[model samples]
Target: MDTPILRNNFKSEEYQINMGPQHPATHGVLRLLLTIDGEIIKKVEPDLGYIHRSIEKMCERDSYQQIVHLTDRMDYLSSHINNEAVCLTVENALQLEVPERVKVIRTIIAELTRIASHTLWWGVMGMDVGALTTYFYGFRDRELINDIFEETCGARLTMNYNIPGGLMFDIHPNFVNRTKEFIAHFKTKLPEYDLLLSGNIIFQKRMQGIGILSKEDAISYGASGPVGRASGYSCDVRIHHPYSNYDNVKFNEILKTEGDTLARYQVRILEMWESLSIIEQLIDNIPEGDFFAKTNVVIKLPAGEYYQKVETARGELGVYINSTGTKNPYRMKFRSPGFSNLSLLNHIAVGGKIGDLVATMATLDLVIPDIDR
Candidate 1:
């Protein structure tokens, strides 16, 4: 077939270009078959499974506590969010009620994780659009947050701090000072990022109106986090269904109606600020109480089904458990955010430039283990 000439809008037929199972621009193992006319793309098919770690099968034999660690590896950037999700679900099934202090702690860790996740995204967004400095600036703040996590949780990327009922341990006495310090330092640096990347001309040119995901399509495909909010869904789990102490803390869910790459980027950047504010409220009010809610080592639940949902940094994470009054669950299912967001890629990628496809994919921020499992 003769190569179809697509217009600059990328709505016409075009010759296909294989971008990668291994490409520098992908940031991870993502293979894209892009059909392009000049620089614009008419179609895109994302080939994933480059990093399938068999998480579901792995969880079948592992203990409930052990599965928390496994969830961490699934979304490596948002490890605390992943840990909180599994913990919340397991706790709910076991009918374990965490203390006020514990809920506050979980909220703190999850929100910090959200900031870290978005920081990673901010850096990658800049890199994808051809600005390296913005990437460095983002990580510079992230490193401080990392240091705080490492001090308390004993790990940075995959902390696995949350157990079934609550945290593995109480917040370190120094947790407050370190958190406040990082917040103060990070707030000072946020404006610098705005000046560097969010306000940059090149970024606007690359992102504005590019890889636009309409409001309806974003919702239908189960897009979450910034992707859904950017489309004006007002669908944040934090607002609609408060988990942990999220209801206690007050914050606005960042939103934009554009549903394009720029809207996604803007929503995320704005959210980091809200996350910071939420932390400020909880930092002082964290009630002094027990950390982990005690549970039997050999967990047994009545024969029934229990479902729990938590707002992860990425989106809604639901864990469905079927119990048969046994040592282990009869069945367990994780409704992962990465899977939903990644599933919608083809819909948005159909009429964008090969490069825009990449920009769009990065915005989704897929972590493959969740999907493959």
Candidate 2:
């Protein structure tokens, strides 16, 4: 009987896996090298540069006007906002004050871009978490916004509407009406989005308490947009810096303290509402004046360093320019929000499941070109 004693020993070893360079959940050509112990994530390392085009270097060779269009390719979802950032930078370097009309118009269009971006994110996020119906609903509304942009700017996704001193052109005759129509339509549909996905028990179970990032960590990792806001970081460029008539509008910078997947998702959902409020405030009050400030055909900046930051759909997009009194920038660099938000992936994603990683990444709402730039 004493000789019948036995023991059982089993050990679990960590293994490595690649989530994507082609995976749909990643949303682009982003490869995440993951270390896993069965269902648990031990580490997440993002392998970027697959889609890098060295846009900053390209800016050195191109005129400032040419550089505006290049930004359209960076964060295509926030193309108009990206254009505005560079335009503001150049205008500031020249000490140019654009017309009041241009300011209100730019603000309205930018908010529309924000809503369009958030709507797309909501749908894609729902799809990522197994709700396919949200994708159709999301795009259906986005199409209306796209139509407005096309009528005004002649393009939808990569709209190079903003130039150095002002808009490339005046707003279309139907721009105001069409934008109002989108606001009216979306106001009703947004509630439906909540009923469909935001309030779902299953979604709450998956999102709540998952991939928790603290306020300190969020700031440390340079998180911004909804990612930083979810962690209670008050880093909204619009609120803090107040460029492009944002100072005139009254809207809340959406924030949450949970710092989990659900908190991030809710912050963006609320932000769409705030975008609506901002557009409403400026749509009718747009002052009558020239669409652009007068500028020379060959724009040149004073020999100095200039920087401008704008609140894009993803977050703060800072355009830094070094000028030697030339048509082209001596050196140009962009501090894209996606790059900073992406940096926090390894920080927040460790210790969650693979499914949790997908949900967390979706909430981050990354546009790979923004990061790779």
Candidate 3:
């Protein structure tokens, strides 16, 4: 066959397009400046700070107890875990040992937060890839967890349950039973998630070998949670640090050798099961004692720097506090997982297609507020 050439000369140059700041696929107010050659992406530069609220700076002015609420806005999905990280940091600095009951409660809530977060991610990830039904299913499971949080902590998304010493209050009476029921209900539904999305032939092909991020690059970029674990990086804070009651619980850290989008997706799916198992271990034998440890009205940390890390739904959330013997911190910084994970976006997305870039971003689960903070 003879090929007919175009009469007009077309200058071949990569065209730049903006993906967000308002696009829904972005999942937040994140703007991605993408340079594309047709459908293939050549570069991805994330323009953040759209939702920046000066959270770190706000912590400097707020009291240690008040500072906990500011973290709620950072990774709102993992707000409970975010609050715990700050509480743990202050507790560690003051050398205050939280009661056994508080530790167990914190652990349970943290796992619930993880599961809630993953469910939402799974739903949105599917929708981002053109699978719409998965969104409803993901939210269906997530709402149950939200109900549990609402009853227990009185807030769904930004539950400021954790305090400097322990929890704000004891767990609700329905907390244990509701969690068990949700777990049992979700177990059957969880398999449906795999059947609907994970097992789809088209999805597998779209994700399996695309946006490949190697283990070394994952470590270098400081990718954590499912993102790092998908690349076979053993960066699980629970397994390594064992904060709160994580040391007592037995659950496998889900790891996948393949560093593709499919591997990242699979890691989070498997992690939901592991999170359920973790909750099951601690749900029954919650120690009977004070839910919060005794602390003074005004908590003043000694002049020193203190750091504490906890595994949120996204990854390792490290809270660093520099106190100058005052109720308010002299300086504060959060090592947010989303920000670190997002740093590797351009690296993995350079040679992939626009659709592949979407899949990769879905798996990365880059929460914008966390990044901007």
Candidate 4:
């Protein structure tokens, strides 16, 4: 289906409005220029880098382990995945072997992070569309996940828990039991989310036909995760590339043909359930072994480059490190998926109503820090 898009807005010369750089809807420090006629958006141009700190460039001056803290700030919601990505890449550099138990533990933590992140997005999206009470439900549920994380890693948001060989520590003895209990309650709570927000008639009317990105457009713009899945593209790195025993599991790649904000919401909702299923299977079968690989505290790299891709809350994040047999890296580059996902904003929101623009942006879940970095 052809999406509603701006046509000759420049020739028509519509009124322009600045949507953000200060608004709550931009997530963090995002600016959207909206060209409007009455309430409909004639065009939207996103201005970023308000939060850029040259994090990738800073990595070259620090040791390999020091870079983990920098990744924590990129997508503050999914810190575990970021830490895992950096550790996996460095491990690949040294050709280290990880134990089965370590792999299972890492997988469990990643899923917990996904649930917390999605819960936040769900409530925030509902609020953006005018339902404020749903936000409380999301945060309440997220607190549980946060508690779990805090007990495991000693930090809630910016955990640099993964080392090059293994994890920061073994999963707590109480961790598995607590996880199972949480999963049961979470399963009960999922239906309440659908009743509260997903099936709301007003939300459907607002989201159904707005901000559509066709499959080809999504692929051409390099969208990933829920955005691409909403457009019928199966582009999940966890499924396609199979990192950290994702290959040994059975799961579906959620996709939709509608390519609108609703499609994105549904994709995320279904993914939460899939993540739960993955965790349940692995928690009981966690093998008994070392948490980390054996390596010296002071790390050095050979004369080569190491690249790693890990699925984050947003999309595929890549860490590329080049070393010339030195303690410090020669070059470091971070490929952030939110940057390209946010780039698609102008194309998708140009012809939509002003109210829909907020909903559309929320569905995309733009992490401005990730984009700027």
Looking at model 4, the pairs that clash are 165-293, 166-292, 166-293
Q: Model 2 off-target regions past 4 Å? A: 1-10
Tens-digit lDDT string for candidate 4 (251-320): 8888898999999999999999999998888878888878887887878887898898988888889889
lDDT of 2 by residue, 1-373 (tens): 3443432233578999999999999999999999999999999999998999999999999998899999999999999999999999999999999999988999999999999999999999999999999999999999999999999999999999999889889999898899889889999999999999999998899899998999999988989888999999999999999998999899998889999999999999999999999999989888888999989989999999999999999998999999999899999999999999999888888888999999999999999999998
Residues 182-204 of candidate 3 have per-residue lDDT tens digits of 99999999999999999999889
The lDDT per prediction is: 0.82, 0.93, 0.93, 0.87
Which is superior by TM-score, 1 or 4?
4
Candidate 2: lDDT of 106? 91
TM-score of each: 0.93, 0.97, 0.97, 0.95
Q: Which ten-residue region of model 1 has the weakest summed lDDT?
A: 1-10
TM-score (C-alpha) between model 1 and the true structure: 0.93
Q: Model 1: residues >4 Å from true position, as ranges?
A: 1-15
Clashing residue pairs, backbone N/CA/C < 3 A, model 1? 20-31
User: What does the lDDT read for residue 123 in candidate 4?
Assistant: 89
Sorting all predicted structures by TM-score, with the top scorer first, yields: 3, 2, 4, 1
Score residue 54 of candidate 3 by CA lDDT.
95
Provide the global lDDT of candidate 2 against the true structure. 0.93
